[model samples]
Target: MLQKNVLDYLDSSAARFPHKLAFADEARSFTFGQLRACARGLGTALADLGPQHNRPVAVLVNHTAANLAAFFGVLEAGHFYVPLDLQMPLPRLRGILETLSPAALVYPAGEETLAQALADLCPVLCAEEGFAHPPQDALLDARRGRVLDIDPVYAIFTSGSTGTPKGIVIAHRSVIDFTEWMADACQFTHQDVMGNQAPFYFDLSVKDIYLTLKCGATTHIIPKKDFLFPTLLMDFLEEKKVTALVWATSAFHLVANSGVLEKKVPSHLRTVILGGEALQAKQLNRWRAALPAVQYTNLYGPTEVTVDCTWYPIQREFADGERIPIGRACANKEVFLLDEHLQPVPPGQPGELCVRGIGLAKGYFGQWDKTRSAFIQDPRNPNYPDLIYRTGDLAVMDEAGLFTFLTRQDGQIKHMGYRIELGEIETVLNSIPSMEEVACLFDPERDRIHCIYTGSQESKDIAKLARASLPRYMVPNLYHKVAVMPHNPNGKIDRPKLKEEWIHGNDHRL
Candidate 1:
């Protein structure tokens, strides 16, 4: 049986499968024993810097074997790890640094420029040098002894509407609970080989990393470029003998839409779990037609409630236009809907989806007000100490208790398994000197982002600036420059009219 914390999972797995391959990237792989040794070495190095337990350790590195070791190393040092995207613009990265004020920053060699800039905030430790030191068993053991299951394990920053990124703090218990339920629910085993598709900073990768480690399974870190080339991705999956894939819906669509799956199908794949956006039956049909034996599931959840709170296994076929149901809540988790007045809505009535369970996060780091507002005391439960997360997602429940996703009740959109706030795009665009006004629209049917803006600068130039500040998924693909933005009677930008005009006129430049 898995223990109550992630560290226990690590210790037990390393003891059981000391020589078995645990994690890998494009460059190399690590055995369970080697992973533990490297993490212990880094932990001892970190402990030498002094005791800073309960503080955050910023890890700025690409998705590689070293990065994986550094994550466990942070925990081994009695601190939580915060993974930051190395591609983020310095201005935006600095903003996160201000909010985090991390105890130390860990990065691979050759990032000295970034290390120096943030050195004023905290010490910068090079992972290359840290891992070179001999393992100090006594120091690592002492640091690990201070750790607790309820303590924060990681804090992932997601796009926020307030022109800043919000860090979602998750504890060790939440990961343990979610991973335990996921293993049994998905039927994961030590013999399975898992392919990782999500980035380390994204919440989806949490399942890929922890579940693989806990189950003593091998994890192949698929490269970013391979996803763009479906044929190559399929070949790599076959080469690695990846039997399970927990990827975003867009990834599967890319293969089906690009006609790559027609050329090659991943023969070893047994389980396909898709999330981050609603799955179209058309796309699902393409995969089902090719691989009849594989099990397909649709997962749904926000970062605030861990990776996924609900799941739907695809057993029956659906028409092209039909959307897949998000299914029922996972074991040990509860999902219900509430109207605008915070009262329970009857079946078939649209309501805001709320989730309550052991999978819930610890709330936004350093933003008490924001955390309290979104994660409030459950009004429906007066007898027990209960808290539920208002998911900001509008959904309706059928007679069978399956949830059909309606529309987002907020400015957020899930693209490529990342929850993005459209306001974050406008915030970065509005920062441009020549930008007069900006609005971002999402056509869910097409899974595309349309940007309508009135600005003196060239549209391409605006996009260039956006690319620097925002992740690729959040950057608008279709750009439109208009003489003036449409406004309603209230003098507010008429987003509906703008969307309608774009659809009718076909004025998008790209």
Candidate 2:
């Protein structure tokens, strides 16, 4: 049965196992008792902020234990949090604030400089200690109440091709729906030690935080420094006896293909979840060859739907297919494949993916028109009907009626007035034996689509490879090979970083 609220999940889990270990990053660990106290304290401190209190609170932090603490703490406080990593540039960070006018901001204890910059607009809170301490025994008394059934919980910004950013507003109800669906399927326990490889700003951290607090389980969080070292990551996973993991496709690929992960798999690990981007079969094959005992899963969802809306449990009979199909809708959420006319498209035809139920967000912040336009009232069902979020990604249903993702419907360009699929061309390029990874983006201002590639391909041969697979306009006007493609906190290819480098020649705006 669905509870009256999502925070009650922690209440129930805490009662069941209060003294059990709850969180573990690299340097610290906390029990359920400690974790709850910190969350409630922080929640109490912000409770007095009135009904207008539902505005966005910006956070400049990383994936530390403090970040997770603040994530739940602020959500429980009844305000939506917008996390911005400290690693992003000042100009980009300023642009995000200008677009999404948050109510308050939080920063790491020592980042006084950043906090000072934000203090003029909203109150700035500094968290120096981990989630387990500091906030405890505070003089600030919270006006305790209940988390509203319809309050927005958080907002994540997606890079907009329109020279702006879109902040997706998710609510507490959606978080509960996703947590319930995930807990039932994953079967986590206090015995499991999970790792947090993603940044707190990313949606992947939602699972890492909730599952730990739910079971009083311990989480092994990796620091920013270790992301560059593949061997160190393998050692961390094995040393901590990590039973489950939530990360991007690239993180696991770094370990599976690295010679250190050969033959020795963690025996206790039961589930390995991958999301935030596409997963290739070759990456899965490499991990399966080593960690045969670990059951794998590929999760899919936009920030609009909490963390995940659908999942495909990786099976042993895995066959090599062109693309991995994003599985059925989550337990409490409703999934619909709709045509251009907003009607349900039949199986095996391309259409837009529409989502409803608790998994759907309240809507985009500050953009009521876009919100109402995208979150449509479904004409199909009336009883318990909710607005459906229109996912702009184009998808086709499989024979089993599951969704097979093709590409983003809006992420294309027009050259010579002809429409082009930037992703399709990149997919073809990545298929070549010499290519390792590729990114394709259109520069509308430049009137040209550009590509930045990584691998062993010679600069002279890029045009040849494109000639074999891509049409004339689809082929990039310029190509460059670098050591590796950069990624933002969300694990997607960092196009801002790419554009910055292309413009300034040595900018490290990561």
Among the numbered candidates, top lDDT falls to: 1
Q: Count the backbone clashes (under 3 Å) in each candidate.
A: 0, 1
Q: What is candidate 1's lDDT per residue for 1-510, written digit by digit as tens?
A: 535458777888899999999999988889999898888888778888887687899999687878989998888888899999887788878889889989889998888888898788889999878777687888877787777877899999987434468999998988998999999989999998999987888788888899878899999999889966778898999999999998876566556666677788888899999887666676678788889999999999998998889999989987654657999999889999999999999999888999999889999999999999999889997897899999988888999999977656765677777876665566566556466567888766667788898767887888898888778999988788998777432123567677677644454523
TM-score per candidate, chains pooled: 0.82, 0.84
Off by over 4 Å in 2: 47-55, 91-103, 128-146, 256-260, 263-267, 316-321, 379-386, 412-420, 441-451, 459-479, 496-510
Error of 2 at 199 (Å): 0.8
RMSD to native for every prediction? Answer: 10.2, 4.5
Across 280-333, the per-residue lDDT of candidate 2 in tens digits comes to 665677678777888798888888778777788877554322467778887878
Q: Cα lDDT of all candidates, in order?
A: 0.83, 0.71
Best by TM-score: 2
- Candidate 2 — which pairs collide? 44-142
What does the lDDT read for residue 228 in candidate 2?
71
